[model samples]
Target: MVGIVKYNMAKISGKVVSVLAKRGPGSGGTYPGHIFTKIGGQESISKLASDLKIGSVLITGTNGKTTTTTLLIKLMSNDIQIRKSYENNILNSIATALLTQKGDMGIFEYGIRNLTYGIPDTVQKLIDPIGVVYTTISQEHTQVAGIKNPFEDYYKAKKLLSEGMQRGAIVTNADDPRTALIGLNKASDVNINYYGIEVDNVEDIGGEDIECPKCGQPLSYSKHFLNHRGVYTCQCGFKRPEPDVKLVNAEFNTDSWKLTIEGDLFNYTTSQNVKFNVVLSVPPFGFHNIYNTLASITAYATFTPKVENIESTVKEIFNNLDMSFIPPGRFEVVDIGGKYVGLGQGDNGDAIKINAMFMNQFVDGPLEFIYTTPDENEEEIFNDHFEVVKSMNPAHVIVVPGRKSIEKAKEYYEIIKKEYPDAEFYPLSYDEMGVRIEKLTELARDSDYDYVIMTGCGEEQAMWEEIKKKMINR
Candidate 1:
């Protein structure tokens, strides 16, 4: 077994994986991981993870794990030998652990299905994480998971890391009721910290809120950030917990926002707390990323205590981070033929709604929207935000093909046409990714518009890179 493990580790290495990556698009990053696990097994993973000096951080939730982990690495990169995983699957995570030579701390996002799929067992056996973050809980992949209640099943999945952590800090999104409830239910011995944003108006926009799980009563919100996330309450006396790290008095600037943070920072290792009053200047992105940033900042403070010069430390951290840190295909902008095109990419309906809301509220111009609709099952989701989209008053609407089928795209186009009778609807055939971007660019160049907003999900996600390449060359 030892000999086999060594041979597999040698064969399915980082170098080998990089070579495979260059082969083709279908050659996914996770392929080498699958081969590594098949040959080396859990024993190999354990051996590789044991070499890390600072252990690892396991971040899990329905959304924002990737972005939050990215931010965590950025904030903590200076002090620890931290490495991050863009891929959340445990197989790829283990393969990453084996391949990277000097990663003392692993900042990895675990997929929500890891617990249900029995992958966390391998993760737990390998690096008993030093810190765990539950970003938010929402309905996702119910059909694939073969579950009826996405909220219940997914809640169980996300709670695994908190329950598994024997002696480490756990960060929860206080604005999210499910995560807040889970944090409240944790053992008293566990170190828990919460992060949330305070806002003036709380509307039930995305409509993901069901009855309060504890009280079976309607949920109330003082501020609603996104679907099923906000400062919430129930008739049975349950309410959103006060966050340890909170963002308050957010005032928007031209391309940025000024916010004040009033909280006590807790060092995960020392169990020490320090009070801080610091104002931050944050660059612009979608609203969801604000929560992501807050979650990342709180997670960072858990491990890192403030220096004597707290103001400088806070300034340094915020100065380094901005909307630029957001991953590709999310509120990404490109310049093509003297036109600014904004691309919002997401895989789910709620994400689309949030992106639309951001564009509606923050952006101004004669807007042209090229909307790539979701699958048949989720077709109506965009329509839920139709009022918001219509309020943006897009001059022209272009319908691109969806992941499910061309029919799905046409279905959405028809639906959108009925809603906005005045707006032009141009139905384009689906082709290669480059072809799609080229068509969109040509139309945007010819159109009278200030911003060409392209929103896509699933298969249309591939267009993000092609669009970027074309725009850069132009």
Candidate 2:
């Protein structure tokens, strides 16, 4: 009884903090939750989460968490009110949304770099989410906070997010074996709604092979959609799960993309079967976003109370969707006068490849690749990124420090110079991010090549988005 009183008081105080914090600098999205957790303790988070009548849904994975969460929020919001938070991927952010927003459901993007930084199991227990969405897992952040987080441990950390859930649904990418294995393992404990691409028109040109998550042996793939994500099978008999929601057909054009998606999944809120098929005309948002669309649609169909509104809601949201739905600093191809420059954050290998693939669509003539080198202790990322750079066959390559450590960038540049003897290197200081952004923007803008791609590793909003704004505004 006393604990209940304390929690109520904490909630009130958190709300007050949220109201006051918003009037000042910064978004203050996590401050109230930080204060509330400090005062009421971690145990209070479950009680706080219980405020949502329909419970919460958490979106997580390596690449598309923010975009998927944003789309899910839009789809769910049309059916019912939803408390949401994205870009900020922490418990405090979710807690702040719960404390400040009034809604029946909560949609939060929860990023897990590794177990050391993210308490996935604890978050699962406390949030007790009705839905947990996985947006394609890959090798990202090999080292977190100076600790070498192995792939096995990283995979385990992602699994722990949905490992303890007894109810609700697990919405995962069927094309990605890592996320598919998660669903297959949890099939008995909860509903698994898988989403993937079924069309043959979408295929990756070249990518490295990945090992089977179930067996140690290499997985055989008949088709490759994205890096490490495709239709595959293993000697251990583990293979891609049949998708409940899938892109059955797709028509990609320079101006727009037409996607025919079909879904037949169990709606958690209504405890009933729901199905829908809709063709959406969306901006040429790239192939990665196709997966994001399926993920968000599957998650929405799984949790939305208004199951009947699935098709209508999806069409209403996606058919009229714009490039603005993409999160800040994400990959986008911009037309500067007649020149085509594709720029944004491509931190990891998978992301860099995706950015390259997106940029490839716009590259007609000689393209200058303005590459950004990853920080120290990120050699693996550089190796993977280098592979993509070689594949692009750019007329020229420019290397810049995307993170701290100018020396490391130079080292990477020397390696690139071995391949392209004429490749240029810019030893820009990460401390002076503004100068770096300006240089990157200028390189893309004034380049002799009409086609330029400035992407690799960098701060998503601070560096990439700022550079994008400058190039577009100029």
Candidate 3:
């Protein structure tokens, strides 16, 4: 076994290139050093995978992975010295668990885009994970692996996640088709747990009928709320089973980041995504902070069943959530001489979609927006942020252009003049930006426009800090 593992690790290693020549035509593809490193490391890795019960829970699917994983970690971290990991898509807690003595429980997440990065082989080991959570399904990486059927793609990845689960449980969104389809037959021998909102039974959004050892078929409606979940019926007929449970209902308030499930309310902080109805909210992400919190509740409640500790842990997290989740841009308020400003990147379209676009949540009346960018040519940068600028409806949109930025600002001013001819666009000189910012603060005071937004990169927080200090000192 040792020889086979070493040989397999080497077959795809970089040593083949060194043997080809010290300097070869396609040498960039693999380095001989990488081969040596990987070969030398296999022994330690195998031992790590085998020695104990490293409870791992892989959070996958598109949307709620971050929210769910974050909340799950929050619930378990207080008592169990849990380890975590991230792979761009989701935190890779498995990696964190392997590196720490305290990490007896590994709760990690992964980003999958079909064949391009099929589920990693480590997750398929029978004893690998004691738990798992699937957030939801949507076209996260449609073009990556050429998966024509979204549901089928979801099933394949799910099956791989549950492949070796002999002892631990598999948790799926009982409401999402992507997860619900991975039924008991998928892994009859392993433990399986299903969770959906109580509202789903009422709304008829989740679950279906089966002999569903867990729930019956024809999948009669208990209730359904956001997506698919609720009471279900089967030919054999079953309804929500005991112990491995279902939440009664959920209400999420985006503005305050408050979540209420089964009449038990929890307040989340700004860092919490409000659309946290895990299985219902899909990829690219929506503000489901509440759903994410609830999913954590469900996952912990269903698998662990140490109800008292789990419930107490959740209450503890909520108590600490407010302090941990606020002041995302490092502070909550940005002020300058009696006026306050909000900094923005305006680059992440999803936030805008939820906050401004669909929600019609833009501010009313005169406000100032200082948009900056590296497009030295101000005209390009101005044009680039045109949509956001237009959306801000600034009383006087100031383009703090960099070197070579005036042309762009002038172009925008001309364009704005053609319609709201009274509205103006000002291009501030690079050397006098601080002076210009002060001038804007004075204008804000004179005009009674108390709210300002500084949009761009890196400069937002610093400028806001100065603005706050100026306002305080004034």
Return the number of clashes found in candidate 3: 65
**Candidate 1: residue 388 lDDT (0-100):** 46
Worst 10 residues of 2 by lDDT: 20-29
Q: C-alpha displacement of 97 in model 3, angstroms?
A: 3.9
| Model 1 stretches astray by more than 4 angstroms | 1-36, 87-90, 113-126, 141-151, 187-189, 199-210, 305-313, 333-340, 380-388, 391-395, 422-431, 459-461
lDDT of 1: 0.66
TM-scores for the candidates? 0.83, 0.98, 0.52
TM-score of 1: 0.83
Please tell me which model should have the higher TM-score, number 1 or number 2.
Answer: 2
Note the residue pairs that clash in candidate 2.
none
lDDT of 1 by residue, 275-313 (tens): 667788877665777778788778877875333444455
Better by TM-score, candidate 3 or 1: 1
- Per-prediction CA RMSD (Å): 4.1, 1.4, 12.2
Residue-level lDDT of model 3, residues 1-474, one tens digit each, is 346566445433434534553432211222343453366443433444454344666777655575577777777666566656433332122422343324556666665656435654454552266666766553332233233435346446655676656756666666554466554555566555555554422342222222333333334544443333334445554334331344444443333333334322111111111112222211211233344555666665543323446556666676456423321222223345555655433322222222222122224456765554433222333443455557656676554442335665566556655645555455666567587557544544454466666554223333544544555466
lDDT of each: 0.66, 0.90, 0.47
State residue 34's C-alpha deviation in candidate 1, in Å.
Answer: 4.3
- Model 2 C-alpha lDDT per residue in residues 13-121, reported as the tens digit of each score: 8988887886321124799998899888888999889889999999999999989998998999998888888888899988888888888999999999888899999
Which candidate, 1 or 3, has the higher lDDT? 1
